[model samples]
Each structure stands twice: as C-alpha cells, then as structure tokens.
Target: MANKVYNFSAGPSVLPEQALKEASAACIDFENSGISILSMSHRSKPIENMFAQTEQYLRELMGIPEDYDIVFLGGGCSLLFCMLPMNFLDQNATADYALTGVWANKAYKEAKQFGNALAACDTKSETYSRIDKNLKLSDNATYLHVTANNTIYGTEWHNFPKPKSGFLMADVSSDFLARKINVSDFGVVYGGAQKNISCAGVTVTIIKKGLLGKVNRTIPTMLNFQTHIDAANMFNTPPVFAVYVMNRTLKWLKDFGGVDAIEKVNRSKAALLYSALDNSKVFVGTAAKEDRSIMNVPFVFNKDVVAADKADDLAKEFLEFAKARGLQQLKGHRSVGGFRASIYNAMPVEGVQALVDCLGDFEKKVLG
Candidate 1:
C-alpha cells in the first residue's frame, strides 16, 4: 500500500481512512452477501436496506425534522440550481440570490434563465472577499438562494442572513454533512456528496415534505423532486456503490460521535492553520478575517514584500514543495490564484498541523 498522503482537494476530497478500508472490504464482497454492492440489483432487498439505512443515519446525524424528505438524487448540487426553481418558481415568481462567489453566481445565472432572479446582495465588486450584510432581499421572492461556503474564495457565512420573504435555500456542497446545523432553519438544503459525504456520483437533497409539486413548470419525472421522494430515492438505478460508501461513511461519523464531535475538530484544525498564517510575515490569508472559511483556507504572500508578478510562480513553487512533503492538492482553483488547503471532515487535525508547520518553514526560508 502507498503511504497515505494528506489530501486537501476541494471536491472528491479526502475520506476517513477507516471508511475507505471498510469500503474496500465491502467492494470485494459486501457483507458476504455473495455479490459486490455494485453488482447487486438496485431493487434487491440488500441494496434497499442499504438505501434506507443510509437515509436514516444521515437524518439522525443531521437532526433532520420529521417533516423533511431526504432524497438521494442524480446530478450534483448544480442540478438543484435548476430543480429548485423549476419546482417552486412560476409566472411572476422570483427568487432572491446572494451572489457571494463563483458557485452562487452560476446558480443565479441558471435560475435566471428559467425565471426571474433578483440579486439581493452581490460581492462581485469586492472580488468575493467577504459577505455583504446589507442585503436587499426581494419582498415577493419565492425563495432566497445562497451558497453557505465559497469554496474557491475561502469565505463562508458563519451565520446565514435572515430573509424578509420566502423560505431559505442553501447549496452547501462543501460544508454539508460536516458539522451540526439547525435543519429546521432551511426550506431546502442540497449538496453533492463528493466532499464530506462520499464520492461524486450522488447528490443529496433534503426538502420540506409538503413544499414540492406547486410549480407550473412541467419538469421531467427524473428532474422532479416529488418523483424522487415518492419512489424513496429508488426511482431509477441509483449510484449503488456510491450510496453504499456513503452509508459506511455515515456510520463512521456516528461512531465518531456525530457532527458535533467532528465540528470541534474542524474548528481546531482551521484555527491552527489560520494562526500560522497570521504569525507568518511572508504569508497572509486571502479572505477577510471574520469571513474566513473553516473548510478551505486560501493564503498568499504579502505583496508589499513580494511582487504581484511573482505570486503565481511562487504559488506553483509552494504547491510542488508541499506535495513533495506529502501534502497533496494544495494548489488553489485556477480562477482564484493562491494556495487553498481544504480541511474537510475526514482530514485529521494532525494533517492541519503538518501543513501549518510547512507554512512556517517555507516562510522562514523565503523571507527570513
């Protein structure tokens, strides 16, 4: 087996080692059920139990209200950008979007193509460095859409804004299933499972049971949230292996003391790395201090000391240096250049400390 390297990729990110090991065993022969999870029939009793158990575990872990229907659907969180509006928006219906970063912008654009979309608040002019508090929400909106964490910009809403009208909807792909949240606060919460839950093939949608089936748009059966809910997330051939892995992951999280326990570790990990950046003269965090994300941390060299012309080159150099030291995927997203370390739920606190130590060592060598 190859030595396990610390991975910080924003999506398809690191998973718990125990979960991986268990999945490896199950993939070979799932509970000695005489077939792999992938080989088993999606309609078979075994797979059905896996699906039901996974849903139950996730609901329990997140404290989802009995009024909510948790459905594992196809397509990523991006699909929800369209599905959400298609299911709720109609003539004269508008949705309020908080354009905080790239993901939110994309969601707004998609929703706008279908129906009226109002930008309640936009931080594009600020290069998405922070969230705008003085949001002008639409009074007649159907729902307020927001991305809880800006993965590329390394900014997050520590607390969600209060919308004046309509229910609150969030795309929390990067932070979903990671920590404790008041599920009752949201009308809809959706995420792609690639980051905190499982792999890339499955998307999770948790919505209020009675809120769907009101839109005038005639969506295809597969795209309809109500269809998926009615079928119990088994309408079509679901991502069997992905759901199995997610089930194992949820079990691991439960055994590890659920979201509350993991969130404490997440906070400590982020604090360690942010403290290291603050202490380093050569390195500075990119996001506003209060808006810094606990999941993704982007840092850059102080431009006063280092020329901006060399920022990209320096970032590339540091990425290679860290990779050689067993830190993988430290490069930031291409649109926003810098180094981003994604410390997800599965990433251990030791991994964060190692990265922090590497940052200090690099700063000392480059600027001391």
Candidate 2:
C-alpha cells in the first residue's frame, strides 16, 4: 500500500488486498485451468462453481433465507432502474418510493415511465439531509422502493424501512456488505457489485422466490428477474471475472470475521471520522446526525467561518492539503460538493485514522 493513497472513491471503490491478489492470479491462470476467467466458458463447471460459490458465500454472510435466490445479472443498478419496474410495477397500480437521495429519485422517475410511481415521501428539498421513517405509503401499492444507502450525499438508512404495505425492494449498492442485515425483512434486495462487493461488471439481485412472477405483463426475457433465476444466473453469459472477484471479496469478508465483525469496524471508522468532523472548527458534517452513513462521510470545511463565502476556495485548499498528505479521492460529488470520504468495508481503521488526522491538521493550520 506504499504508492496507493487511502482510496475513498465511492464506487468501483477499494477492495481487500487478499481479494485483489487472488483475483490477479485468477486472471492469469485460474486454479490451474489453462484459461483465465476472462476466457472461461459460462457453461463450464468452473464458471458454474464460481457463481455457486459466490452466491453461497453471500447467502451465508447475509443469512438469506431459503425463499430468496441470489442472481448475478449483467447491467448495473442503472439498468435495474427500468428493468425493476418493467417486471414489478403493474400498469394499474402504484409503485411507492421514498426519495431520500439522488439515486432513489432516479428510481422513482424511472418507475413513473412504467406506471403510477408515487413519492411516499421525499427529502430532496432539504438536500436529503435525513430519512423520513414515517413514510406515507399505501398498502395496496405494487411495492415500496428505496435506496438503502445514498453515496453522493452520504446519508444512509441504518435501519431499512419495513413497509407494512406491499413488497419492499431496496438498492443497497454502497452499503451491501458493510453491516449485518435481516434478509427476511425484504421481498427483494439488490445492489451493484462495485462498491463493497467487487469491480464494476455485475449486479447482485436477491429476490424472494415467491414474490416474482406476480407482475401482470409480458416481461421481456432479459428484463425479467425470473429469467436470470431460471437460468441460474447464466442467461446471456454472466460477467465471469466480476463474479469471480466478488466471490473472492466475499471470502475475504468471511475470513475477516463476517458481517458482524465488519459492522463493528465500520461503526468505529464512522465514529472516528464523525468525531473528527464534530471537533473540527473548519469542517461541518452534512448528513443528519441519526441518519448519517457508515459507508460515505461527506463533510464541508469552514461553512460558518468568515471565509465561508470562499467555501469553495477553502475546500479546494484543504483537498489539496489532504491529497499531499496521501489522502486521495477526497473531493465530494458534483451535486453536493465539499468532500466525501467513502469508508467501505475494505477501508481499514488505520486509513480512517489517517483521514481523521488530516482533518485535524488541516483545521488547525487553515482555521488558526
């Protein structure tokens, strides 16, 4: 990790060192097989076993019930934005959405093209500082859709909503494996395997087996979740290398003591960064206190100071300062700019400590 600065980029983010080594070996010569994973046949037993292992590892880690089937599909959550409604949203019914962040808003917008997509509640007016736990939803709606974690604004649903009405679907892309979850609570939970899982190629969809096939429509083969399930995640040739790397990442998580262990570390990392932000006179945490994300920490420097009018300039100065101190990807998202330090499951406590140290040092030097 000498040349590598502590990677805090949101997606396609940092992965475990052990997982990386194994993935590199698989790319060259996979398990003594003559071909690399890139060239491996999807129908081959190696590929089949790889997919099986990945699902199994994930199921075990998340304690997914037997009723749920974990399938790896080609497109990212962006594709799912439309495909999800195509299969689930009925033309006559409404799809309830909790617009807590940008992606959630996008999902709701996508659903509207399909049918009546209702915004049960939205926080966009307030820049999505918080989550509305008491969501006004209809029990007769098709399903309640929510993004489990918002990477851009650094707000997360520490407690995922359990809607009494209709089915519950979540896009837990950023915080997929960072903490333990009650899998039985959701009807369908999906995420892109780029942030906490693996590189950008596959999307993992864990849908309750019975909940599918209920949408009244002639669903296309590719867009339908049941199609992928029926094919055992082999429809149209899965992303072999991505699934393999994700399997390795899952294995690393297990070796590192599973979700329970990682959650403690994740909380610690969040606490470290949040503590620094709270103590700093030059930095203010943007996310709501109770709804702050453990995965993404977005902070603004000196928002209340006399130089607040020059906030952008001060932010740039601090960004460059932190970059010089070996903290990379400290720039915040374009929609909400200041700085965002995404500490995923792979980000060790030491990396967060280094970032916290940078925050303290920058505040003392720039503020004083």
Query: Which candidate has the highest lDDT of all?
Result: 2
Per-residue lDDT for 68-121 in model 2, tens only? 988888779799889888888878888889999999988888899888999888
| Model 1 Cα shift for residue 277 (angstroms) | 0.7
In candidate 2, stretches whose alpha carbon ends up further than 4 angstroms from where it belongs are 1-4
* Whole-model Cα lDDT of every candidate shown, in order: 0.87, 0.87
TM-scores of all candidate predictions against the true structure: 0.97, 0.97
RMSD value for candidate 2: 1.4
Model 2 gets an lDDT of 0.87
